[model samples]
Target: MQNSATIASDFAELPATASRGPLRIEYRWINDAAADTRADTRIAVFLHEGLGSIAMWRDWPQALCERLGMRGLVYSRPGYGLSTPRAHGVKWPVDFMAHQACDVLPALLDALDIDMPARQRTWLIGHSDGGSIALLYAARHAGALAGAVTIAPHVFVEDISVQSIAQTKQLYETTDLRNKLGRYHADVDSAFYGWNDIWLNPAFRQWSIVGELAAIREPLLAIQGHDDNYGTMAQIDTIAQHVPHARLVKLDACGHSPHRDVPDKLNDAIAAFIASQT
Candidate 1:
């Protein structure tokens, strides 16, 4: 793992925010120095977890972009990172994640001028909540994406997930978890409640993307850890059952965050999957 000081230095020269209205998005680009200077390599847009921000991703995105010989876009959603804070006393609607998938992502893509004609090939690499957003985006914008790699994404709220979230709530209240998360989220409460309230909501408990999974025809790779406490292997299993052609990878002795827990193994698998698609 890259130390916080090193991560800070890498991001030190990044461009400052140009706007802070309805959405607070920051952007960065990575160019392949090793390639023939003229070619426009395809890009990978990384979406972080609910509590994650660009700063939290550290050097992983940079490392991946370098390894794949591609550019990368890493940003913070509204209410996280340096973006706009969530409205006070506002509770996210049950379909908040859907809104993010259908609205915010497209808006950000357009804002960054990433919607080029032949540049239609986009690779989405998302983690946890971001992973779910990636799936939803692929479901809606079918042919626009080359493929997606999702790690520990949830299609529905499992009992295990709820239980773990409940424990997280307790930890937040009684321990230093909030302070730890504060390092990532600009407004930790906003980020926490935005995600926590939705998952614990009665209506959201039954929320499932099984229908959407079937609609996704793009190449898909869903990865989960066998020892993940927040969700079971059944999440990816269900996706595979719905989208029979989707490939599934179950990592042994791993937890929810595969990229963080098993970086080399996860990167190798993702690289092979992307190559196979081409």
Candidate 2:
């Protein structure tokens, strides 16, 4: 028996649903032509941040897919978006992000039927926690990957990361944060605490995948903001140290989320990297 999420391409600018393992996943393909036989058609899978879903990504994936002329896939992981919410008593494990990378992502890809040239041309574009997941997936499945790009990814836990998340936890409780996030999730608490709790857990302070990055043979680009609120440049710097061939892009006047803060620059860098890699 295998664990996987199942969905086909050819969606009409709308999201679709599928089931992965015991969880139902909400996913959608962008600008995909089911019958297009162009040799250069590519696939870029977008992995959102810890508290992000397909809706939270807004039109960024569509914009990037158009910019790079590649098919794109976006999804909400378990306990996110319109997918099944986390059970009331269930708590995510310390290795939640790693499980997302090693287990959930692979299963989703298999179910999406990415066993074509897209498999070889596939690129993972991840942000924040998603960036870390992208790195782990590339390390574990380099042979099936073409390239990867990470934005503000955490290779290791940092004091500042914990501080900011803890602060946001307060916001989620005291402010309209939950109301704002509610627009993107079916169960805001499930989406919020599922990510928040594990990240702030004492056991997670030691969570780091820096050692496994050595196995990533695929072309990789790591991006970070000069003024990121979460992790520091050490995150991407460590990535460069581990994967010597990985390209590093440091953006000035940017914060944690580059796609939102500096979309033009991020898009250009992504387009250039993919062009150069291809």
- Name the best candidate (by TM-score): 2
CA RMSD of each candidate after superposition: 3.9, 5.9
Q: Residue pairs in steric clash, candidate 1? A: none
Q: Which candidate tops lDDT? A: 2
lDDT, residue 14, candidate 2: 20
Candidate 1 ranges beyond 4 A from true positions = 1-21, 31-38
lDDT (Cα, tens digit) per residue for candidate 2, span 1-278? 11112233222122232522365778888766522657667788999999998888887887888888787889888888877788756889877878888778776787776784667788899999999999998998868888999999999999999999999999999999999999988899989999998888899999989999999999999999999999899999999999999999999999999999999999999999989976
Question: Residues 191-275, candidate 1, lDDT per residue (tens digit)?
Answer: 8888787788888888888788898889999999999998998899998998888899899879988878888888888888888
lDDT of 2 at 137: 89
lDDT values of the candidates? 0.79, 0.85
